[model samples]
Target chain A: MFSLQGYGPSILEGTYLTLEISFVSLFVAMLLGICGALAKLSGSPVLRAIAKLYTTVIRGIPDLVMMLLVFFGGQVIVNKVGPLFGYNEYIDINPFVAGASTIGFIFGAYMTETFRGAILAVGRGQLEAGYAYGMTGLQVFSRILLPQMVRHAIPGFGNNWLVLIKTTALVSIIGLDDMVRKAAMAAGATRMPFTFYVAVAINYLLITTVSIYLLKYLETRYSVGVRRE
Target chain B: MDFAIIASNIDIYLEGLKNTLILVSISLIFGLVMAIPLAVLRTSGNLYVQAPIRAFVYFFRGTPLLVQMFLVYYGFGQFEAMRESVLWPLFREAYFCALFTFALNTCAYTTEIIRGSIVATPHGEIEAARAAGMSTFLMLRRIVLPSAFRRALPAYSNEIIFMLHGSSLASVITIIDITGAARIVNSRYYSPWEAFLTAAVFYMAITFTIVFFVRKLEKLWQRHLMPLEQLDTKIEAPSI
Candidate 1:
């Protein structure tokens, strides 16, 4: 049958992979973002320099290049290092790992800036107050700074996460069989590029709409005490 | 293979840099010109005029640019009727398709940015212009645009840098920009380290130029808009 029935399941499958990739990568990126922000604000010059280099290089390189490098370069590294590191001889980075890592690396740069700004936005005196309360640095960060930073970070973090989700579409070029690639294949098979592409666009719109609503709820829940103005 | 050996082929990298600059600058200039009216209409009244532009801004902003590029290039290419149309020749040219997509994508983002800036212009200034018997057109020209542009300078600088980075995506549709050139070199030499590294340096250089001008412009605006004494006395703290 020359219809969209078959297309739905394929797209739905791709959507699952896409979500899996984005969620895992975003989790990793969040870790890097916090670490990078702390490093930038740390007293250690070497750590600051290292963090700066990480963000700069990641931002400087195009995502497409980074994805390719990670995918191809990772394969080469794993082949050599896996045996030496006591892993399976045939251990290789699948497309999902490669895509997530590259996208995570790229977005982590942006998230670092977003997080650092959020951290700074939380009043400097707030941290001092935590210290005044006889809390250690670790305690101060967890108890006082982290909560406020989360509220401040939500808006910027949400925007960056949206971009991160869309950026996952680029992984299709590297054999991840994301929505775009599946659409391309289906279009090629059915000779209906416009319809197939529109299907993919609708899929993107659905995911994005759901994400925005979810983020809005989080924003509302987090901003409980503060006046929005 | 020593990475330093790639220096012998600096000429190719320079050529790619030249092309990348061409694509970025051309699209950005045209995008800027397109942004003004779009921004004006976006924040203006009249749902009939504003609704379509709003939808456009949402669509382009909501989706990934890579997919949009594919729609313009491969999606349209698949249409036989479109091929026979007057736009066919233009669309057939990969460079033209790349520029068109870049221009449209940047237009959406710049419109949103410029609209935000325009709306953020102090309401008191507009009221003062009205009280002083200024015409709508005259007030906008004399006060609104200049101030809005100033207000928008910081965000606009980031937009421009992004455009420069975005120009790399043109290579996906077969326009031989810097990234494409780098990929070619990598495949030929089997040394991605050198090729991608060179490309990264080129992007960093472009980014440095963007930041340099942005700093200079910010300083100029800082001087013109607010006196140094007041600026120092009250730093406008960033709110996330």
Candidate 2:
């Protein structure tokens, strides 16, 4: 009968949890990505090597494996460190923190590539002009490099964002009470798994649809002065 | 940290690797086959044919594969008709459910990648084919598809790797792929680092192998597009 008798509020809460995880993870990802891109671009060999190793290994493995390792393995490490610091009680790792950081770390590798390409796409002449106009290094970066890099980065960023949003669903596997988990619970209780999962699926589609539009709007907003080919 | 656990349990890991490989290869093959027509339809200039396919691709690509797998494996059973249907036996198996979800998920991504390259195929080449008295079918077969595939190779290779990574989700439905193997080891020996890191190493090996072969294939396919001098560096043709 496709009935939803009593699971509406919990499902809404799950949706909020999903959104909160996604946004927090996205912020962390962007921060790591910019740092990674800068490190790879820097002249220091050690920085470049470390960044390269991180991106290569992170990109090579599955995110689910990363999630499992971070959640459980991280707990072991935290507990190990806790007793050493004279705090002997077991420290429970929050699934939210574990899930967000893992997802953030995984996508940071991808975003590094996108940001690197975007940075490289900005012309050297433009940076030189900024320098010639009595601009400091930070001024050159903020004024000349940042805006154009964002424009060039938007397509790849949009792609990464879409994937990142979908990737958040994996957090449920690690026992986060996200929308998918909420749906599973509802499905089990109501014995209408189809309806509940479909509900989750529809919510995801709606979010993605809205994201695509919002990304397009940002693209337009950033592309204000540029002429379209 | 516990290397001994992995060393002692290598066989179980190998079994998991085998399952992962089977799931990835079968799903990739099926997904690729299904994707070709969908890719073509996706780019067709008609709305009716394109609309539904676009919706299908969007729905699949927009949601998580984990959800799709759950919807198929658990959700399908909710319907009385699906349970009573003749195909229920096949659907009941966890392996089939995983395979079906993986195939459908990869098909959506592969379709978009192929469609992008198909649309990107140079218009001038199509014109040349048409001018050479080629029919539409012949043009598509000889020029369009080949050129499209060549252009698509890089992106398609990424999709293959993504699918390989995605195959880990089979563990969620209890199919026991590499990730599942790691989970088992983690639960048993309580050494998460050794268990998942071992599986991670296996994935990295597979990923490197794919990247190596794809790079070689790209170089081979791109020969004609490269300048003659760059094409045969060893020959060192006379300075001209």
Candidate 3:
């Protein structure tokens, strides 16, 4: 019962890749979400329209299709354009970039919604008071809106992150050796789909459980300044 | 670059859309029916009953729907007993599998959302109903679901939009929905940009339409509260 068969290595390796993809994608999405939310909230119409388009398109398309289109379709674009620029080498999108970019781009839309709601939740009174005391919009945002927005946004952000982690399972279809794909491979090799898939489920549960705890900790820390009564 | 193939296959795409609609509508209706009972169970305060419902919600909501779909389809297909069993005919159909998963998944989310709304119904109203010697079932039927429908309406609308999008995933497992049609076109023609972009535009249009209806429904349902809310909002607006 305790035999370490063909399953262990692939599962472990896939776990690392999944974690790497998730972390990098989440970081990129956060930056993108913040910038997108700020752009939408910006006073300029052009910036707002652009932000709106980004979020709307990402939200509308199914995550699976987007991943396939970006991974397969992006490769085509890259290959076509590559040979035109003096030197042509066969450059393919590594599973990491494909996985990370797709997940990040999609979740960035969700995170934009989270951040926008949180920013709006930050009372406008404070910003007005800051303005009365000669604070600029940039100063008001950084010194006032940003902190409260982060706090209010934590739970929603946590939810989005959880969904994002699960969506990464789709990446396995396009040859990213994530936990799901690795388990599928192991299952193929070992002819035990149930056992391998169960292992994949556990891997996801582990990652999700740990992330929830971290999000909880961050939530508590962020609430410190505002919860003083 | 060849428009003729896609142009000629417009009928296939329409057929696919019809199948997608059938799957979505049936699952959503069934999900709604099941959710009401499950919501009642969840809020009943009997640990023996509520515990299982809680567990079911957590298990379903905590996991991705695609995993559940695959588990039902491929995972269960692994069992010869399942394949040959009385349920085999039903399970063999991708439509049934997708609908089953969609219904069950949406039920979990909807049950929680509905239960929250029911619980949030004014205690005064419940007391008034009970004070009048109303039966439990009667009170729930006449008072709870009706009132809770108002509160849950917003969340249910969100779920509706989500399920519409979720229907797209059914294509992955050979359901041949709108998304399935798009994939078929993409592979044969290698025009990923047009194929996928067209699908995205269609989905966006549908989502926008659903959202618009949800907003209208919200306003209609909340008509009585609007005046008070508007007054409160007006006061808060200038202050904010």
Model 1 lDDT at residue A135: 94
Expressed as tens digits, the lDDT of each residue in B1-240 for candidate 1 is 446646867777788888899988998889999999899888875999999999998888888888788788777867778989999999988889889989999989999999999999999999999999999888888888899999899889988888887788887777677788777877777676677777778888888888898898888876866665856767587999
Better of 2 and 3 by DockQ: 2
Q: Which numbered prediction scores highest in DockQ against the true structure? A: 2
List, residue by residue over A94-160, the lDDT tens digit for candidate 3.
8678879989988888898889889889888988999999999899889988877888899999999
lDDT against true structure, model 2:
0.92
lDDT per residue for candidate 2 within B37-56, as digits (tens), equals 89988887599999988998
Error of 1 at A145 (Å): 2.3
lDDT at residue B22 of model 3 (Cα atoms): 86
Q: What does the i-RMS of model 3 come to?
A: 1.8
What fraction of the native interface does candidate 2 get right in terms of contacts? Answer: 0.86
Using DockQ, rank the candidates from best to worst. 2, 1, 3
Which residue pairs in candidate 2 have backbone atoms (N, alpha carbon, C) closer than 3 angstroms, thus clashing?
none
Q: What is the DockQ of each candidate?
A: 0.52, 0.90, 0.45
What is the Cα-based lDDT of residue B39 in candidate 2? 90
Write down the worst ten-residue block by lDDT for model 3 chain A.
A1-10
